[model samples]
Target: MSGPVDAELARVVRDHAGRLAASLVHLVGDFSAAEDLVQEAIEAAVRTWPVEGIPERPDAWLYTVARRRGLDVLRREKRHREKLTGVSWPTEPEPDDRLRLIFTCCHPALPRAAQVALTLRVVCGLTTAQIAKALVVRESAVARRITRAKQKISDAAIPYRIPGPDELPARLDEVLTVIYLLFNEGYLSSGGDRAQSRDLTDDAEFLAALLHRLMPTEPEVAGLLSLIRLHRARAAARFDENDEIVQLQRQDRSLWDHAAIAEAGRSIARAASYRRPGPYQLQAAIAACHAEAPSWEDTDWTQIAVLYDMLVHLAASPVTALHRAIALRYVQGPAEALAAVDELESSLAEYHLWHATRAELLRELGRRDDAQQADARALALTANPAERSLLRERLNWT
Candidate 1:
């Protein structure tokens, strides 16, 4: 049903869709219209590229087609005609279109929920289904939120540019949220063929670094950068040679990047110097606790639990609570942690990690059948290959 050309096109689209959409939005000044132009260009490619073979610069070809279509739309609508004269085919030294677009989407005028949904959709190139899973909501709810958010952007005529210095602080929280979610998606990958995607994580790190460069005084930006680096430093130890998930406590400490971990520690110190504590800063501190530990048994669970307590005070959510419960498992005991986790069941019944965590606690409590059932539920809910493999092994189904 498909050919090499189709496969190549898919790969190109998958790799460059966010950059292309950002460029189109920059040209057309409409998020929804830019997306429509991209779809139209993709359709045109589907029809033409098969016969012509792939272009030497397929991304450029798609952008050219989409730009021309956007121009035509502008002419027909007779709106933003001024943008028509200023727009040209992009060349080298182009602005950071994706970053600018992220700021635009994270405007304070829009609801915070809509801001994150739109950025994840338009800037991160996540599908509605993927975003729904990440947000722990129904697909229909995600679709509606995205549609309304786009409409609100169009209606409000939000400028497609980065906010000024005076505006950055007001918009920083949502922007940080979007980037954090982007990194989280890459770290564990809510749903996809791969267990993880370095591309998404790399993109998030690049964006965070750029933000740090732009606002050097912003501690939260540094905190976020540190958080990402700390996680990436330990990434190599997260999986074994068999590609199965390796629990943090059981991972080889030798595989960890000590230099990067130390560098991240300095970043946390820098963020702390600002004395403007926030959720990201606290999270980075928690991650630093793990990264700085010489051994699993050397881990300072008390400090981690205290940090989680502070994080909960700043940003309370079911997921955050679940994570706090996990830290408590070491500080307190499995039974206490089990009680905390059980309270979240009604809220996190569909979440794979929640089930997986419960299985661990149940096993600790010597409830064999309950642990098996929970592991089975976790395997059913998750699409991640590594996690599924780990769960299967735990259930002795390997």
Candidate 2:
């Protein structure tokens, strides 16, 4: 392939492969089978595109080809008849292939990890490397996990259609979690020194916005929208003029996007109007506490502490608990916060955030030497240059 042709093929593959795979999984009723079929289709495309040029509806073409290839494999393996009993393919293509696929991959029958990995791979178009990085696992580990997930999808006889309203509420959490993780991975670039992780943020926004549009009355959808929009408002300020990391307290608030902040407030208010609060809403509320504060001193650490307290009940994650500790120190004073931190020290021993928070709390309590040691420990756990740089700078403050 020539340089331009290869580049074009790569672009098309990157852009549409995941969506195609999702559609195929929906059609074929097996995530693993769908991945194999999609890869086979892309191989065909690589050969065809170099000769016949690119097609107009490459994504649809991919979906069509992958589905056919999947059927062929099943037929050759003599499982087509049994698989045919499981699902009835439509004579005509559905209008919302991607949405149908999303619902299928997020089916309540699948394990949470399988749902997340499949969604990140097929819906978000992330490579195994990127997905592994996002999940903080090795690439080979992610590959093996994905392979097994697909096999389980086939063996467990999972359906390939959107669920009824009764199943929607229960399945919605996994979907939202996948969307949030995708956004965060993009925002932080997960495990990388790359200048930026594209599409991770964009795909997240697109998925969140699509959900908001599809379920206009769903408060949780609004909560997720608010969470992503508000967090992204400061994405610009997270890095400095030289692309180094800047602490949230030190970030130039002036550089934060007012428009994104406004949108977040709108979503948060919309979700609040529903009278049923959720994790995203509570987290967005905490973010709002930070965004609305005129200065670090003016920050509503007290309210943030309250919000985190609520979040602990809603989400029950150690990360949230650690965050709450930081806010508690600011509100009830360092001693109470240190107590809270110590309670979580064992749970968060390996998390960089824990050490960073521990160091800050120790410094607040006038234990400079211990605080410095904690900061160094925290820095040691970091792989992100921006975060590492920020932590190192904090160490020099001693």
Candidate 3:
């Protein structure tokens, strides 16, 4: 029961909400008040814009309405009267407000879950229900986490600006982790009907580039960019013409983006020159090895395995070990890789990839029946539609 005007308004509001909110927070120095103003502006738009027709500058209209609303509140409160006189509202958000907002939301003071939820809500402009769906958590839990995070920010008076150079390295890493996770989710969506969603990955890449421009000297920043670019380079060949997932070995490398791959190489070289062997740096190096290969058989699996060894040593996680096992399968042999995977059975019991890996190894060893069982187990454990389809195809082949 809405017209074109209403639909346009909704699109504009969703696209610009985070930037508007961030600008409001910077101007008013209050997170809760800024969010409230934005909600009020949206309400006003819904009530009036559809009938009046949409404005040419919708973002400016929203910001002006929110600023006026803030001014009205301050005018009525005697204590905030002087503060209102000093305010200078911008016609649009500053170029860096979104980035600053992300850093503030991902502050180390907040719990990791709260940090992620807050960033997705306040910086990504996702609704609680949308975030809950993406995270596979209850809506109530997401709401509570966001509420507590905002309350903590208010109570602690967390500054609404980017940290200085001395603190930037540590804080930037946290921000990078969140962005990369967002990209990964988009790259291989866990629950959506489609295999990929370009919107999330596009946003993440935009943010990553922004961070690199802001802190060009940080090696990990370059490394993160390198990692993302390398993945993006191969995006064209990830799925077949039928939209079915294509295995890496079967993908047509000619479909890859040569320019992006070359840029990734430059980024990796720059990161290496800094002499900081971080997890991202090592991972990028591994990715570079694959990008540089002319064909699957030409890949330097030995170098990749060595890089994973370094990565596992730096950050000992089940995921890293799993990746290392994959590299081992290429360099050492099916038997050695199978042994490594077996050792992780207890730790990765519910993880679909573990079973999938085991199935591949078993298939290589000519244990067709065992491989079929492992593929069935993997299909059961995974919720992703694309992954399920791949597993089903493999199972049928067995």
Candidate 4:
């Protein structure tokens, strides 16, 4: 492929693959087959785009290829054609294609782990490795969960549409998990060379907003949307002019969008009025503490730590524990936080942030050599370019 065509094709695929896959699944009536059709569409682009030049409407072009291929596959299978006889090629995009796909993937027939893994793969365009990292599980486990979930969908004939109102609550948590992880990937990107991808965050926020509109009384939806907006409000201050990671303590508060923060505050207040606090609301409350702070030193660590404690009681996980340890550092001191972080080594040893947090605490305790070694482990474990750069600077390797 020529350089320009290759670059453009990559961008198109990165930005639209999830939506394209969602549409194809709707047309094909099979999750696994839709994914294969998407791959075939990409392969077709690889073969033709360089020769023909990238299409003026690359996403549309890919969708057209995938749709035609899906029809061909159904025709070849013969018996399946009867099942989809009423389906026709859509003249315009469905506004909720991705959301419907997420709901389908999160059907209660599937296990919670499978629901999360499959939705992250097909609805959020996350790779198995990325999903594994997000879930703190093995990559092989994530792949198997995705495969089994797809098979279960096919066997059970799960309809590729949003659930009716009564069924929505049953599947809401899994859908929210997928969207939260999607936003996290965008906020600090796990797989790509770039530090962050605004496109992923924008997609996540769009989905959350759609969910909020669909379930206006759902506090967790409001909480998730508020959490995302709070982070986005400070996005401009996350990196320096050279695009190096800027620690939150050192970021220029003037760069933050105060109006956006205010809007998110109202969202949190709205969520609280529901009087049904959940993990997401607690997490958003914690983020609100950070976003509302006048400076890092003025951060309400006591309140943040209390919120984390509530979160742990509601939904404990290794990642949550690690975050709580950071808050503990600010609340109690390095000694106490180190003990908490140390207890998580067995559970989160493979997680880069675990080592990174340990390094911070070790540095604070005057264990310079141990701190350097922990930072080295973090550097080795992570593929994220920005994180690797930050770790290198910490180790004085830059």
Off by over 4 Å in 1: 1-100, 107-149, 158-170, 190-192, 195-198, 339-350, 365-370, 380-383
The number of the candidate with the highest TM-score is: 3
Q: Which 10 consecutive residues of model 1 have the lowest summed lDDT? A: 190-199
lDDT score of residue 316 within candidate 4: 96
TM-score of each: 0.70, 0.78, 0.83, 0.71
Q: lDDT for every model?
A: 0.78, 0.74, 0.78, 0.78
Model 4, runs deviating above 4 Å: 1-99, 108-152, 161-170, 190-192, 195-198
Local accuracy of candidate 4 as per-residue lDDT tens digits, 231-326: 888888888776778889999998999999999889989999999999988988998899899999999999999999999999999999999999
Clash totals in order? 0, 0, 0, 0
Model 3 misplaced regions, further than 4 Å: 1-19, 38-59, 72-75, 78-100, 127-141, 156-169, 190-198
Question: Mind giving the per-residue lDDT tens digits that candidate 2 earns over 1-398?
Answer: 22555546656775677566655555555566767777677777766877898998787676667666766778865564355345433334443566666776676666667677777666655566656755667878777767776776678876666667988787777688878877876677632365533336666876788678767888988888888888788887787667787778988999898878877887798789989999988988889888877788899887898899899998898889888888887788889988988898778899888999889888978999999999999999987777887788899977
What are the root-mean-square deviations of the candidates from the true structure over C-alphas?
5.6, 5.0, 4.2, 5.6
Q: Tens digits of per-residue lDDT for model 1 on 1-398?
A: 13455445545654555677877666666778886676667667667867887788877887788777777777766665566456665443244676677787788777777776677666545556556755557889978887787788788887777777877776788799878877886687622345422245755776687678767788999999999999999988887777777889999989999999999899899889999998888999999999999888899999999999999898888999999999999999999999999999899999999999999999999998999999999999987777888888888951
Clash list (residue pairs), candidate 4: none
lDDT of 4 at 135: 49
Worst 10 residues of 4 by lDDT: 190-199
Error in Å for residue 153 of model 4: 2.5
Steric clash pairs (candidate 1): none
lDDT of 3 by residue, 308-364 (tens): 999989988887898899889888899999999999988898999999999999999
How should the candidates be ordered by TM-score, best one leading?
A: 3, 2, 4, 1
Judge candidate 2 at residue 94 and give its lDDT: 45
What does the lDDT come to for candidate 3? 0.78
